[model samples]
Target: MVSQSAFAFICCLSLLLTFAHCKTLKRDVKALNEIKASLGWRVVFAWVGDDPCGDGDLPPWSGVTCSSQGDYRVVTELELYAVSIVGPFPTAVTNLLDLTRLDLHNNKLTCPIPTEIGRLKRLRTLNLRWNKLQDVIPPEIGELKRLTNLYLSFNNFKWEIPKELANLPELRYLYLHENRFTGKIPAELGNLPNLRHLDVSNNHLVGTIRELIRVEGSFPSLRNLYLNNNYLTGGIPAQLANLTNLEILYLSYNKLSGTIPSGLVHISKLTYLYLTNTSKALGLMERARLSLFKHFPYQAEYHLVPYLGRPLLRTNHSATLPHLTSSRPNMWRFSLWRFFTR
Candidate 1:
């Protein structure tokens, strides 16, 4: 009795598999309605109509996340930071081929950043910081080799600093500070051996911090090297005491000169040393008999105290201070909790 041509051949194979699952959920709802009409459609994209990946009764759109795949959905994650999405940066958001996290940092975004965004090869974390993004950082974003954390700070980018970001072999936190960038600084970013916190401080970068620590193993897991207020001059590079896991060394207001390098105060992991705004343009004297605290190998390491002036007169009161005044003890104003409690 059930042979009406085998139930009309199982109803034409369940209507051709539900018309190919509504044609892959209507092509991920037409690429999320072309990124909500290229980021101009507000009212939170009007609840992105027509069942956007939340069918069991419909819910998903707003900041759009969607998941499933074989059954439908798609658009992985589009955070949309700061709401007020103005325009420009929406190159149809690389058409959501399973986007991995494209947070459009602090909106009001202007132009530039579209070198087709290195086609987002599953981008890791690319927050376009404080937008208004001007030209030149797209050396195809080093083709996002699964980028780690690239926040283009303050924006209005002026170019230069892109030595193809050393092909991002898993880049770790690279914020291009205060943008208006100029030349030098790119000693291939010390070949990014998993760079850790490298801020190109206050740009107008001039060079000669010996291309940043003369490049040996270079920034080997660097811990916070800001290169303060650029226009940088010479003389702080005793290979920066080879950044022995440096801990906060800003190099304040640049135009740096000599002295301060007694192997950089024995970098037993310095705790905040800004080089006293370059001791009044390196007039840092006291080298006649060469004893920057006898290169501290320990004599209780000169009673370790001065961070802003007071305790360091113990080589038996080191001949009663005053070798070049400026009120002595300015080992660049210490006190970063006395180098992590001794």
Candidate 2:
């Protein structure tokens, strides 16, 4: 009788939970419709937990995640990439008090992003790239205190980057390339404690690029930086050399003038380089001083087969060299080469 009573009690609790879950789902769907209407012609195949009347698996529906017991109170993540969705940023997501991640990248999303997005307290990754988003980035975005990866590239966004972004204590990767953003890079941007990759290229931004290199004192975790195709007109910032982990650099198609910063001589870890069409002289920026391979005690050797066709450096020099610089089938015919070999 005790076991039977316990089973009946558990069954009663489950029924109550199902009722509560259905109620929450109805509320969430009502909220989503507001966003969908603003989207107009844009359509997304999004799954938010499940349609309360869904015929299949209830939990794994398009943009929906569920609680362990299949309840509806917990909303975990929203990844809506490449969905071809259009129109303004959705503000109804604020109602999902428990949503952790929100991604709507590679879509046709338009209009200024809603400032209410800061409500996603647990949001860790927010990707809104490859959209038609315009206007100045809202400062309220800094309120997503837990953000890690932020992708806002390929849009018509303009004006100064919001300095309030420095408030994000855990921000890591930020990609804002190919936009209409103008003005100097914010000084406070250097204060982001965990910033790693920053790509703000292909914009109309003007002014010096120094503050972004070592804004406060150092850039311990920064790696890749792409600021090409802009109106940045000045000497390369010397502090940029302090970024030891920098591997890839693209500064082409800018109005930047003056010689490359001498500090670049010490950046030996760089593997990819693109510094063409700038007012800065090219010859001076070719080489970087590296820890001598021989002196580095037992360093691992990463050998590459000789690349004789094109210079590994991505420069304006690719056209000048014959197909192969080291040797060509025609080079053997020279009498001077035969005599030197003998």
Candidate 2 ranges beyond 4 A from true positions: 1-29, 36-60, 68-72, 214-216, 280-342
The sequence of per-residue lDDT tens digits that candidate 2 reaches over residues 1-342 is 569889999998988557454434555565555655565543534434434223234444455554432454455666667767766778787766566777788888889988888777778888888899989899999998988988898988999888887888898998988888889777677777688888889888887776465554655677777888888877677787777877777777676655545566466565555655554432222221133222222222121111233333332212222222332222111100000000
Expressed as tens digits, the lDDT of each residue in 1-342 for candidate 1 is 899999999998886455335423565577666767666656355564565555444566766776656666576777788887886887777767577778889898898988888887888888988999898887988988888899999989995888898889888889989999998788777778888889989889887887666767787877888877788887777887777877787866677665556786566656566543332334222341246644543322122322344433322232322333332232333311111111
Candidate 2: residue 203 Cα off by (Å)? 0.4
- The TM-score between candidate 2 and the true structure equals 0.70
Name the 10 consecutive residues with the lowest summed lDDT in model 2: 333-342
RMSD of 2: 9.9
**Which segments of model 1 are wrong by more than 4 Å?**
1-28, 31-70, 73-87, 91-98, 101-123, 127-148, 157-171, 178-195, 203-221, 230-244, 247-265, 268-279, 283-342
How much does each candidate deviate from the true structure in C-alpha RMSD? 17.7, 9.9
